[model samples]
Target: MTAGGDVGGHPVGPDVAEAAVPRPGPVRRFLLRRPGLVDAAVVTVFTGWALLLGLGADSMYWLHEVLGGPRVLLMQVTSAVLTLAGAVALVWRRRRPVLVAAVMTVLGVLSLALTGATNGFELGVALALYVVATTAPPRTLLAAAGASVLALLVGARVLPLARTVGAKSLGVDPDDADAFAAVTGSGPFGFATSPAWFAMAAPVVVLALLAVGLGTLVHARRQRVAALAEAARARAEEHAQRTRLAQASERAQIAREMHDVVAHSISVMVALGGGASAAFDWAPDRARAALDELVDTGRAALGDMRRILGVLHDDDGDGPAGDAPLEPQPGSLDLPRLVGRARTAGLAVRTSGLAVTGLDALDPALQLAVYRIVQESLTNTLRHAPVATDVEVDVRRRADAVEVVVTDRGGTAPATAGPGSRRGLVGMTERAAAFGGTVEAGPYGQGWRVRALLPWNEGDA
Candidate 1:
């Protein structure tokens, strides 16, 4: 009945992935969280076994026979104590690799000198050597490894050779070194010896070098994987930053377009409303005509607003286009209508060099910039220069660029505040500069003039 698929008040699932996953116990969770604890546990267990075997069966009897009845018990007790202490010391090997390795090695050498057996301590020494190789710096690791090799050589080779000489001095047959009675039958030092020195020493050397080599390889592999993971993380962050910047830029562009469209349309409508109110009493016919033009301009502006919003709402266009008609965004071709709307608002608009002779050579974005710059300049002229009777709109094509200039004479009235204050100039500049163009807007010889020069790249059209 629950979301996890509990049936008959008991949890059950047929999904193998869910069923196979069982909750971990507290101890298991603890070990999983701290991997070093698991490694320490394993090392402790192995070392403990080595200690027990080496002391109990491998070397205790030989040591007892060699030391004499009076001192045999003391030597046996001492050997067991030291061997146990050294095995326990391996628990802290990872925390202080070099120091632990040295401590364990010294303990191992003392044990071998006392009992001539190193099975349990040998495992601890090997583990310490591996830890040093993986965690310590190069010089420290080399020093630890060298000490371990020396301990193995001395314990396995030198100690056995010394025992052989002891047996000969006690009048035992050196040739029959493996015989149990050879040394015991002649004197106090006794017991069957282990294999020849070379035979016993080779395996220890191989195992020590092998542990160090494996630890080095594991360290190298971990470092390589960490570097790769860091690189991947950095790249992912960079890509996310780029995506954010692009989204912010897109939102800003949308805001500027909406501002241009609404401000221009409303400015024209406001001017017409004033004109219509003035003519209503003296010329009713002219007032009706102005009202009609206002209505048309408002409708066109509404349509353009819908088109812009449609690109956001149904970007993929799977819905009906009649609701929010999807149309090509207006570019240079829409400038004529813009000029006409300005003229209808009663300003005496004159033009020269309005021909688009080289428009086919410009990119779509550059053409859009040209259209928007002209549109904003005209809107500014209408709002700020209401007393001016003459306005000039000009477009000229040069060798590498197309220039647009809008000039308006000063009016009798001073400038008044307008919607989207100063943003019109900023938007114009942004649009022009996006295509590697330049914009200049300021006073020009008793009139305000706005000029923009956009590069014409014929190959990119």
Candidate 2:
């Protein structure tokens, strides 16, 4: 199927949905979202605190009665309105944290001024402080913290404490001061009578500030580390994808060269051998010798081709024989056989400069490279040189490299060019390059010559 088209013969639709469905109202939709649920829970906790402190506390009884009277019912109504507004501020705490924090801070200061101290009101202040520290940037948070500290100090000085000490001095029963002291420590209006009230309150405020700063630093550090790890993983995956693409391209090039080298040469050898066998009675010894050489040459080519095919197939699975040793190819040791094969193919083959005596032994890969170069050159001569041409095969070992030359003398006219004439030269060059070697091939002195120089101890394949 074509890309972006369905298998059922239809074009693919847009990736994103086109139609918009009508959603419920803001409150209903918010209740459905996850953050909305958390906001609802926070508001509920604040409401419970307001109820317990504003209505249920005995200390608030006189205040409630005075406010709840019909003559001044607006005071109680105002208190209820302020309490609800503080709780509602939490709904937008995460989405608009700075705005919510400012609203909560203003409401908290007003509530303390009007009622002295309420139950759930301190929670709003604490939540505002947390939002300022965690959600805002460092500079903004620091500014907010400084403003909050100033507000707290102003509240401590301006808001009057309930008359607990006067009740004790007058014969009226006094309420315990521990609960009030817990929430509002020894400042100007605390239960304590010490002269260093500001000193004691200073440490508590500093501790709260330090706690918020540390929490913000830890959270920011974790987020940065997570971002770095995600970027590293993406880069690693991209590198792996590029590596696979390169390997696939290399495999395709190898397959094309193998098809040209193995298929063309072997097909010609098979046809020549068959013709020679059929004409054996007409020409006895020459035909028989040609047939024998053809058989040997075809077998050698088949073996080399099989080894190459095995390597290709092995890439898809474990391998044939599950790790059996690969069958080795012909090297300089089989040069005579290669020459005989050329002779059988109707070419006069000669050799010179093949001495390897008293020289350091060559690596197996280099030996195979020299052999393939000679083999391809002879195959090209048989396929391209004129009939009755004499071919020369030469090999010499240098200090660090082995030089090979294949030269042919044209007899009458040049032989007809076959398919992939240039490709054979490319394959020969690729083989030499695989072992850090170089090849030169062109027509010279009435015929063509191919030469290759391969490193004796180069480590590449």
Model 1 scores what on Cα lDDT? Answer: 0.71
Q: How big is the positional error of residue 307 in model 1, measured in Å on the Cα after superposition? A: 3.1
CA RMSD for every model?
9.8, 11.2
Cα-based TM-score, every candidate: 0.77, 0.65
TM-score of 1: 0.77
The parts of candidate 2 lying over 4 Å away from their true place are: 1-91, 113-137, 140-211, 231-235, 242-246, 249-253, 256-264, 267-281, 284-302, 312-325, 353-355, 358-361, 386-388, 409-411, 418-423, 457-461
RMSD of 1: 9.8
Candidate 1, residue 444: lDDT: 78
- The regions of model 1 sitting more than 4 angstroms off are 1-37, 56-59, 68-80, 151-204, 310-323, 358-361, 418-421
Model 1 agreement with the true structure over 1-461: per-residue lDDT tens digits: 44454444544434422333344579878887998877767666765676576556534455456557557566566667876677567777768878878887787676656655555566667778888878777787888889876876566445653355334434455567455244423233222243344444555567678878988996786576667556555544554555567668878898889988998898889889989999999999999999999999999899888877665554665653347776766766777778888988877788776666666446777777887888888888778876576798898777788899999987767655455469999999999888788899998776789999988755756
Question: Which residue pairs of candidate 1 clash?
Answer: 50-120, 51-120
Worst-scoring 10-residue span by lDDT in model 2: 12-21
Evaluate all candidate structures by whole-model CA lDDT and list the values in order: 0.71, 0.62
Ten residues in sequence with the least summed lDDT for candidate 1: 183-192
